[model samples]
Target: AYIAAPEKTAQAISTMSPSLITFKLEGDHLNRLNIPVIRRCLEKATAVVVGPGLGLHKETEEALKEVLRIVEEKGIPVLLDADGLKAFANFKRRLRVPLVLTPHAGEYKILTGDTLPGKLKDRIEMVRRAAQELNAVILLKSNVDVISDGVRVKLNFTGNPGMTVGGTGDVLSGIVGAFLAQGADPFNAAVAGAFINGAAGDFVKAEKGYHMLPTDLLEWIPRVIDDPMSHVKVRRSVPRGL
Candidate 1:
C-alpha cells in the first residue's frame, strides 16, 4: 500500500503490480497525509517506507511530524528518503525505532550540514560519524555506495551507470523496507538491500545497456535476490579453423 499525493507519482506507483491503498492530502501539496488513514495502515504494517515521491512543501512539515510520532509510538522500522530527508534534517529528538536513511551526496550534506570529503577514507569516516551521531544506519549512494551503522562501514559496488535514472532509489528503499518487515536486522537489511538493488541494476545494464529504466530494473530484482552470486559466464570460442 502506497500513500501518494501527486498524480504523476500515483500513476507511476499504479503501474507497479501492488494493491495500493491511496491517501488524500489537501490539494497538490503532499504536506498533510491523512492521519487516520496512515494510523490504520500502520496497525498492519511491520515496516514502512516514507518520502519516496513525497514532495517537500511548506505545508507538509506537519505531516512529517505526524509520521514521526506514529513511527515512534509504534516502534516501526522506517526507511526515509527524498523529502523525508528534509523532515529528518529538522527533527531533533532521539529516534525510537530502527531507522535507515538513504541519502545521496547532496542529501547527506543537507542532513549533516557538512560536505563529504574528497578522499575515500574521509568520506567513509564522515558517514560513520553521521551514523554514530544519529544512531541510525546510513546508506550513502555514490559511484561506490556506502552503508554504515556507526560501528561498521560496508561499500557496495554492484550497481552501474544504468541505475542513474529516477525512482531507482525508491526501489532500494522498498526492498529494504521489505526485509525489515520480514524481521531482518536494520543493518543487515540495509546491506542486503543495497547489494540487491545495485546488483539488479548491474543485471539490467547487461540486458538493456544504459537505456534501461527503473521499471526495467524491477524485473531483475527477483533474479538477483534468488541467485545473488550467479552471473552470466562469458564463453570464449576458438576460431572454427584453428
Candidate 2:
C-alpha cells in the first residue's frame, strides 16, 4: 500500500512496519496517475511530503502542480523538498497553504529567483526572504541548517560532512513526513527532522567513518532517536579551516 501526498508517496508492504517503508517517486508523467485514486488516498492521509529523488521534467512539473492544487483544496499541510522545490520555482504564488520547503543552496537559488552571495549569513537571509515571499517555512539545508517561517529563524548545528552521501535528503523528507503524519506542526516537524537526520548521520559516521553510505545513515536513525546521549559524542568535530 502507498501513502500518497501532494509531492511524494510512501509505500510499504502490509507486513512491514511504517518506519521500514521506503519513500521515493519516479518523475514520470502525471497524466498516467489516476487523480481519483490519488484523491482517495489523500482523503485518508494526515499530511503529504513531496520531492525526494524526483528529477525535473515537464510532465513531473505539471503533476506537482496538480498535486499541490489537490492538497490546497483539501486543506492539508505539505512539505516540499528536492525537485518539489524546483517545480514550484516559477509558480510559488499559486500555493495557498502553510508549506515547509527544504532546499539546498542550488535549489534555494531556483526558488528565490535570486543569486546567493556565497556567504552563510547571506544565504540564511535569502532563505528568510523566500519564506516571507511564499508565505511558507523555509528549511535551508547546509552544514548548519537554517529554518524560518517568515518571522523567527532557527539554526540546526547537529550534522557533520560525513552525512553528505546521496539519498540522505530523501530519508530526511520521509522523516519529516512521518512527523507530519503523527500531527506535528510544519515548523516543528522541520526542526525535529533536521535534528534527527543530522544526529543519525553522526551516529553512522562514528561507526563507519567517512565511508558510510546513505543507507547506513538510515540504519542509525533508530539508535539516535532512541538514545540521543549515546550518539552525541559520535559526531565528528568541525574543522576551522576551509
Candidate 3:
C-alpha cells in the first residue's frame, strides 16, 4: 500500500529481468492505502506475498491486516515474511485462507515468544509446535531450514554461509511465493521452496563464495527446481551450514 518508492523501485525491478511482472503505485505513505487500491491488485493475484521491504509503521500494520481480511474472504494463499510476520504477530483473528510463514530464529521468537532451543531436534519440535498453534506452514530459516505444517515436517540442508547476505531472504520469499502461485499446497510449496532456495545458494557459494548476491542465486533457482536432486552431491559434500 505505502511503498517508500514506486518509481525508483519499479525502475529497479524493470532492470532486474523480463517477464509479465508489473507493479502499481499506491502513493508513498501508508495512509494512501485507505483509498483501497490493494483490492484491485488482489483481484488478479494468484498468490500474495507480504513484507519484504514493508516498513514497520503502525499504518503498515493496519494495512497488512486489511490485506489479510481481503485474502481471507477470497480464500487466496498468502505468505507472510519479514514485516508481514511482525504485523501479524499481534493479529488475533482466525483466518481461513491458506497461510504460510517464513521466519528466521529472531523473527520466530518474536512471533511465538519462544526462545528457540540450541539443539536441532529440539528446535524442529518447537517449530512444529508453533505450526500447530498458528495453523500455518512455518518455514524456519537456519543452518538447516525446518518446515512444518502441523502434521508433516521437512528439513532442508542445502545452503551455506554465503546466503547471509542482504536480499537473500527476499529471494527465498519470492521463490516460495512463486510455488504458491503455481497452486502448490502450503506444505509442499514450502518444502520445495526451502530446498530450492538453499540449493541455489549452495550453487552460488561454489562459484562466488560468501560474496554471492541475491541476484547471483536467482539464475540457479530454475536450474535447482528443474533437477532438485542434482544438488544431492553438494548437499552431501558440504557439512551443515558450511
Candidate 4:
C-alpha cells in the first residue's frame, strides 16, 4: 500500500508503479489509520523516500511528522527531500533514524535558518554546521556539490550548467534513495549519488551541449554508471593488396 495525501494520489500512481494501494490523508488523518495497516506497509518496504512532489499542506506536514516518528521508532532509514525538509523544520530536534537530507542552497538556508556566506569557504562551513546540528548527512546542490556528515566532506565538480533544469534534484534524490535501499552508508550514498548524478549531467552536456534537458540527463545516468571511464583505442588497417 502507498501512503500519501489525497491530491498526490494521481502522481503516486504514475510514479510508483505496480498498482499499489495508496493511503491518502494528511497529518490529522494519521490517527485514523490503523496501526496494523501502517505496520504492514513498513514490513514490506526496504527503505522509504519521503517528500517527492508532496506539496505543503498543514495536514500533509503533520502526517509527514507522524510518518517520520514511526519510521524512526522502527529504525527505518529514510531519504528526505523536497517537502520532507519543510516538515522537518517544524520539529523540535533531529531524528533518530539514519537519514539523508538532499537540499539545494535555498532549501539549505530554510533548514538551518542561517544566512549563507557568499564565498565558497563559508558555504562549506555552513553545510558542516547544519549537518553536525541535525546529526544527519547533508548533500548541498550547487555548481560544485558538497556532501558531509559533519565529519568528512566531498566536493563533486562533474556536472555543468545544463543540469540547471528542473527535476534534476529529484533525480539526485531518487539515486540516493536507491543506494540507501541497497544498504549503503548515508555518507557514501550521498557521495556516490552526487558524483553519479553530476557525472551523468556532464555526459549529457558532452552529447547534447548546454541546451540538454533533465530527461537527457536521466537517459545518460545508466550509461555513465555502467562505464564511467572514457575509452581510447588506436587502430591501424592495411589493404590486403598492400
Among the numbered candidates, top TM-score falls to 3
**Looking at model 4, which ten-residue stretch has the lowest summed lDDT?**
233-242
How would the candidate models be sorted by lDDT, starting from the highest?
Answer: 3, 1, 2, 4
* Model 2 TM-score (2 dp): 0.84
Preferred candidate (lDDT higher): 1 or 3: 3
- Residues 88-146, candidate 4: write the lDDT tens digits: 77773778888889888778777888777778788888898888888899998887788
Q: Is candidate 1 or candidate 2 better by TM-score?
A: 1
Q: What lDDT does candidate 4 reach at residue 10? A: 42
Clashes of 2: 1
- Candidate 2 lDDT over 1-242, as tens digits, reads 24433233344332346543332333333432646656766787678887875557777777778878999998888888888889888677736766888888788878886776768788778788778878888888888889888777888887777667777887888888888778887788888889898888776666666777777777777877788776546654532122
Q: Give the alpha carbon lDDT tens digit for every residue of 200-232 in model 1.
A: 777776666678788887887898888877643
Clash number by candidate, in order: 1, 1, 0, 3
| Residue pairs with backbone overlap in model 4 | 2-21, 27-59, 27-63
- TM values, all candidates: 0.89, 0.84, 0.91, 0.82
Candidate 4, which segments miss by more than 4 Å at Cα? 1-8, 15-39, 231-242
Model 2 regions lying over 4 Å from their true place: 1-28, 236-242
Query: Which candidate leads the pack in lDDT?
Result: 3
- Cα TM-score of candidate 3: 0.91
